[model samples]
Target: MKDIVLYDRNCHFCKASKRLFEKLDWMNVVDWQALQSVNRPDFSQEELMEEIHLITPKGEVKKGFFAIRRMLLRFPLTGLIGLILHLPFLKPAGRFGYKVVADNRTCTFRKK
Candidate 1:
């Protein structure tokens, strides 16, 4: 089973982010889905809207920054970045940074 990343298709930032992943996913280990278009029984609509989600092959779900880290680990080019993010001292900071970006994504894109 492949890992799936659910994102908001309607958001400009989300679409751009997906394009970046498409370019980086040379191994083709990850799949993409539009959150608004998919019905996920395991996750509520509200939960899906709050942040990005990565559904692992083992059925585990990683959300927000952790989701991005998990997806990054599968890409050889980005694996080092993921490893750095997972470092003991940086994990919290990574999560915080991701939240700040996630929270501001709409505004950032809207200004474009």
Candidate 2:
């Protein structure tokens, strides 16, 4: 089973995130899906657009920073960072940071 990630296709930040993570998926274990195209009964479209989502091979769902951490764990080079994010004290902070960034993703890019 593959680890599937759901993201908004229209969001530049989301698209960039997908590209970055896909590059780290050297073993080809991940499958990325655009939120507008996939029929995800488990989550509403609005909910997905609010943050990134990852469906684990075991059918567990992870969102935002948790999803990102999971993706990081899949790569050898980034696994250490992933483990750091899982530390109990850092989890909440990580989630908050992810929300702040995700909520204002448009700010990350602008017309030049």
Candidate 3:
């Protein structure tokens, strides 16, 4: 039971992101589960695909930029990025940025 959990598999970008976090703090504030690794009644594949997924030990679920922001808070560098997104006016911009990234992620990882 990790304190923070992110839903991701071997996605190239996701793996890259995870590697960066791993390099920063071996303390391991986060855990990851491939979509296939768990049966989550609360979220369907369709829903998960539409947003980033994060679950806290408190059983709170957060999605989109909020999820990314949550993960960023664990590390100093990323915490800065997260703080930027936390700005009220920047929230919508952060969401737009996430959608753009999410929409383009398939270019890097194609399904067989």
Candidate 4:
């Protein structure tokens, strides 16, 4: 199933991340949409701004850290990274780390 990734266009980090995904997506299994362009009835603008979103072809939505893990699993190489992130001992930590990064992505990038 094709996956859709909703990313913030105004964020340099988000845009760079999308470009990285394009390079890593050997199977072309994911589709990209700018968060500002999304008008999904199920997701409010504020919700989209809160974090990244991954929507499955079946219409299931995975948000924030979960979305990143799910997207990683779609590719052969990154699947292991996704699996590792979800390991019982690491899941909580991974989620926390992702949240920190997501929340400060703009500032994080600006520091560079």
Candidate 5:
């Protein structure tokens, strides 16, 4: 199991997602971080602002839906879904969906 680094903040959805991952990640594989967690050792702010990022134990950076997929990999059944999410046919839809969720995050989280 890889150490999952999730770059998120105080957004309601982001926080909810983190909690959900915590529930699903039975092996204690994830290390959640706020975008403002200044103590992060692996990722820089510039790198984070460039995209919604996640880093695996192998240190491979994933962004967008791929990051979501990486988090899902912690669960057995959901891991299969994560693999399917990487299919070429689903890439465009996944990217678009991620953008929709991200764009609405501030509003949904009442951050603005």
Candidate 6:
């Protein structure tokens, strides 16, 4: 079973992140889903929109930087980087960086 990543489809930044992840997913260990397609009762629309969410095969749910961290560890290509991101000194920065991107959904880049 593949791990699932839930993202906001309407946000171009979110879409870009999804595309970037797709490129890094050499093993195809993860599956991407739009929040609109998800029907879980525990996940509120408002909450899901706050950041990208990852649901593990074992039913563990992680959001924001933690979600990205968990997903990265699944692929051999990014496993080392994922481990590095988990360092205590980097966790705060990781979360902050993800939050900055997530908070600003207005996409500056246009499809050419």
> lDDT winner among the candidates?
1
For every model shown, what is its TM-score relative to the native structure?
0.93, 0.93, 0.82, 0.92, 0.78, 0.90
Model 1 lowest lDDT segment of ten: 103-112
| Per-model lDDT | 0.89, 0.87, 0.73, 0.87, 0.74, 0.88
lDDT tens digits, residues 4-97, model 5?
A: 5655664667777677777888877778767776566676777675457777788788887888877776577588888888789998999898
Clashing pairs in 2: none
Cα-based RMSD of candidate 3:
2.9
lDDT of 1 by residue, 17-69 (tens): 99998898999998999999998898999989889999899989999999999
Against the correct fold, how does model 3 do in TM-score? Answer: 0.82
- Superior candidate under TM-score, 2 versus 5: 2
List runs of model 4 lying over 4 Å from the truth.
none
Candidate 6 residue runs with Cα over 4 Å from true position: 107-112
Residue pairs with colliding backbones in model 6 are none
lDDT of 4 by residue, 1-112 (tens): 7899999999988988888888878899999999887788888998898899998999899988888888788778898998887788887887898899988898877525
**In candidate 6, where is summed lDDT lowest over 10 consecutive residues?**
103-112
- Residue 82, model 2, lDDT: 90
What is the overall TM-score of model 5 with all chains considered together? Answer: 0.78
Off by over 4 Å in 5: 39-51, 109-112
